[model samples]
Target chain A: MRLMSKPHSARELTGLLKAPTGIVGFDDVTLGGLPAGRPTLICGAAGCGKTLFGITFLVNGATLCDEPGVFMTFEERPEDLEANFRSLGYDLNGLAAAGKLIVDHVRVERSEIEEAGEYDLEGLFVRLGFAVDRIGAKRVVLDTIESLFAGFTDQAILRAELRRLFGWLKERGLTAVITGERGEGQLTRHGLEEYVSDCVILLDNRVEDQIATRRLRVVKYRGSSHGTNEFPFLIDEDGISVLPITAPRRNLAVCNEIVSSGIPGLDAMIRNGGFYRGSTILVSGVSGTGKTTMASHFVNAACLRGERCTFFSFEESAEEICRNARSVGLDLHAHVAAGLLRFEWARPSLYGLEMHLARMQRDIETFKPAVVVIDAISAFRGPAGDVQSILLRTVDLLKSSGITAMFTSLRSGASRDEGTDHGLSSIMDSWIKLVDVEENGERNRILYLIKSRGTSHSNQLREFRMTDRGIELIDAYIGPEGVLTGTARITQEARDRAAADQRERESNRRQRQFARRREAVRRQIEELEAALQAEEDEEAMLLGEDELRDATLKSDQAARAIRRRAAE
Target chain B: MTSDAERLDEGAQEAGEDAGHYYLRLYVAGHTTKSTLALNNLKRVCETHLAGRYEIEVIDLRENPQLAAGDQILAIPTLVRRLPQPLKRIIGDLSNTEKVLVGLDIRPKVACP
Candidate 1:
């Protein structure tokens, strides 16, 4: 945010008195560019791209920045320089024809040339003036200023002439790049930096762990606040681009956008539907934990959303990956055919990590993809610094351009933490860890949402299965006893059902016993009723016998009959 | 190429074996006074001790200064023995005949001590 709001006044303060090199990513570090209208000394050992730097600066100034340049080389011929640069896609001859650039090859054969008395390099000055005037050039490049010294017999005069030459370049109002050979104790072979002191850039090419990295640093830049650290640079077909050693300034405008995870129910794990747009994600897991499958899902999802996606596969070939995805019913090949998906397959051992990064950056810039997937970033095995730099530049390039990137890495040893070998996990906006859990003689894949920035996410471990349809995150089996996986989960489900049936049968037996007791009570009530009726009948018969015995007794019998009737 | 280099080496060996046939290379900046004097003095000494049995090559460093690196030449008007098995260099205008002879690895006849 601070970089985005960099005060305009600050820019003008640092930028007013400078000449932009027009080399990609270099001008920013030089506080605008090289010191304007002054000679800058560039010294390096042989084969360290010293000449290439000078020529590129001139070519860029002429073609891209609309500043014509004059290039005077001391060693190689003009045709050789033109041919060499032609392969780098810079047309020196074409630029010369267009009157924008001039290449003068200064040949100094001592046998052919003579050094007369009382000379001060007026011939060289005249030639340079002619070339500069012809092209109306504002930039000049002297590839290896020492070749001229080798022809002259007097060192005192030669060094004095060199100092005068630099002063003349400034007086002529030209931004000049002077190349020199690195010496043992001093900066240059002849200590040329002492003569040209306006600015100095040091280029170093060293091989570490059998891998080569080229770095550049500003030794001295007069009157400017410039980056002093050594920045690694890339030399490719398109020329040179020095990647600053510092982390990218966070100035990108963030958007509240999301892209879904192709697997169903997976989006819910990351709370706000999916990962934050233009964020870096680290997908770390053990071997065969479906890390590659997860990457396929992300790439496929981006493609399905009609957004372009590029897959950098260091592990499997495109064919092998497509076949693996097809087994899970993901049509990766269809997306490739639809021009929505692109695969960059290369072996990690082929080049240094920086070269791989340069290639990746070039591809991403050309493809303009919305998402990029690196299948197994751990495949780049090198010095720890190399690995860290690879991740830094990759992350910076993706996030600053509003492109989300997913990097998959394989975790070795028994450590299940998502900590990367290069410690890049700390910079990740979201990290998803996959583990293979073994229980009851079966192994199941489970994934965890370790952390996601700017969004809520589930911390619960989700048991995932790679079915024929696709990758599915099923609910973890929480049983009465414990959380189970694979065959143990199935066995636990069967045991629970049997226990429910046993409780149902025990309740039925108790209800049957209550019904039997009710039947016995009903039988006893019936017997009591019958006994009461018999007693009443006996009394009636006795009363009838007494009435027949005498007339006088009739009244008693009638009374007994009336009593019996009342009882009935 | 190996046979050619061997033949050249053998030829140098033959020249050293030939008595009084000295092979010399004189380094000079140009046709200056010091350079001409050094050449004349060397020719006179070689003719007296090894008359008509010596060869000399004068190399002007000013005209072909690149050759100065091949012989590791430092000062102008220096004399180098080209064909001797063990080469020798004598600086200056070769003014003393006795010293020049001694520097050329030849013992000068000590007259009276």
Candidate 2:
């Protein structure tokens, strides 16, 4: 049956009406930009990196867009602020000295203040206006406005003042950043600041399994289109960097060049060559089924072809792998010394998944290797959250870079029909199954090619032995008792054949004994008759019955010899 | 000519007696556009209506910055009425005169026919 596809519909799009927030690289997610010349409140718990984000917005504006900024801090002094940003390689003090930045601190002490019936925010406006006019500051940050709540008891007055402050900023066409402490069930401590501002951002700091991760999400942005996903952010020596996990990716052309499997006789079954270059191959099997052996052989073959290869060893250390491969006639130490192979071992939980991916990308970009091997992909499945997505993206990345990718996965049981843990079979270009079958009282490893795209591979599962010289594929076993299992089968078969031969030998002996006994009986009868005749002759004349007697005696002697032979 | 205490008492009594007038204190960091505009607007309103009774104090926070504690001033160009009970605060340059006058509870006198 044929299926019908749906049609597309067009809708009217309303663009942003507020002043644009001159934040670099941030516009890529915010479509056009943030509301222009309007207050945007950024509220989060303390140490959630809210302050860093505020500083980043201002620094980015000053440096990238040539827009001057005004930072009005209520908690930290200007010196402390400058020192904090200095570690990020941002010269905030220099920018202030150069007249491109303005910093103002409003010191409010609750102990020194008296409550009155009516109040005004005229002093704050004057300071803000002075800073704005001094450098023509287009951006402003009022960090932790909640500090005012501690000095005042009247929420009504504070709310009115906040509304007016936002209105004033809008009137002056100056984009502003107002920061506040987050409150339970509310966006900010005052709860009215979010409504007064044009945009709101929430920053969260979470620790899962002793690993800290910071995330930022745009709660609301009026008159602007912004990404709503929670993007992971990092705070290092270089300030704040947000990684948009769901950003649109660029499509790259994939190459399909056939490459050898690095093992003789195995490549002949696979399309007269082997796996295509830039394709991902999954080597799945139970424990001790020669998965690592096959991967090592592939690496050795790649090295033999003078191609640079990288092996990411997660299950085994580099030295252990090298030492173990020695039994299989694979010497990796020489290849490593010759700069043909590199082995890197790291724990999957060493960092966040994105950080690990970024590190891998950096390494791949730097090395530009022709082949990459991730020994045992099962080790990376759990730590990376969703294994399928990570593997898919990794395959895409390697394929686009024209690098052959090989991964090994350990199955759970002895049955070769077991599926992979991460469900990578659907995407991998080739799936090789290795099994340990019990045959003839010995456990033998058998290798089978399940599928290989763009190539013809051997369909038969052949017996393979690990000898001192390396892996050797023996002829398939053909027997009436079917495939043998373990050494007991072979021992039992030998015992049954030996018993049958013994019974046949016993029957032949009985037949020969019967024939000899029958001949002996006939000879005995002749001797008896001769003896009787000799006796009669002796009685007649004591002498001359000799011929008959002699003949009978000779016959008796022959009979006696035959009887002895029969008895023996 | 008078002691400081006496002068303060006299000013307080006079401020107390003027119930119809709105006593306003503008806390500003320095001479800035918002501060100037707020001052000019308040002066114009007082002169036109409560010319004789109104008292407006312009306090520059930078000069006597410690005075900001007397009234909680979070932003500059903040206009506070101290004479009125349950003090009111209006933030901005007082550009919206109608809203600012209404917010300050100051109404112009109407002549009877």
Q: If you score just chain A, what TM-score does every candidate get?
A: 0.74, 0.62
What CA root-mean-square deviation does each model show from the true structure? 12.9, 17.1
Q: Against the true structure, what is each candidate's TM-score?
A: 0.65, 0.57
Off by over 4 Å in 1: A1-17, A110-122, A245-256, A278-280, A310-327, A331-369, A380-403, A416-429, A438-443, A452-460, A476-568, B1-113
* TM-score between model 2 and native: 0.57
Question: For model 1 chain A, where is the 10-residue window of minimal lDDT?
Answer: A1-10
**Candidate 2 lDDT, tens digit per residue, B16-83?**
73456566777766777667777887788778767887778888877765465446466566777655
Instruction: For each candidate, report its DockQ versus the true two-chain complex.
Output: 0.02, 0.11
Task: Residues A439-550, candidate 2: write the lDDT tens digits.
Answer: 4556777777888987777787766667767776654554676654335444556765797789889998999999999999999999999999988877876455676799
Winning candidate number (DockQ): 2
- Every candidate's fraction of true contacts kept comes to 0.00, 0.20
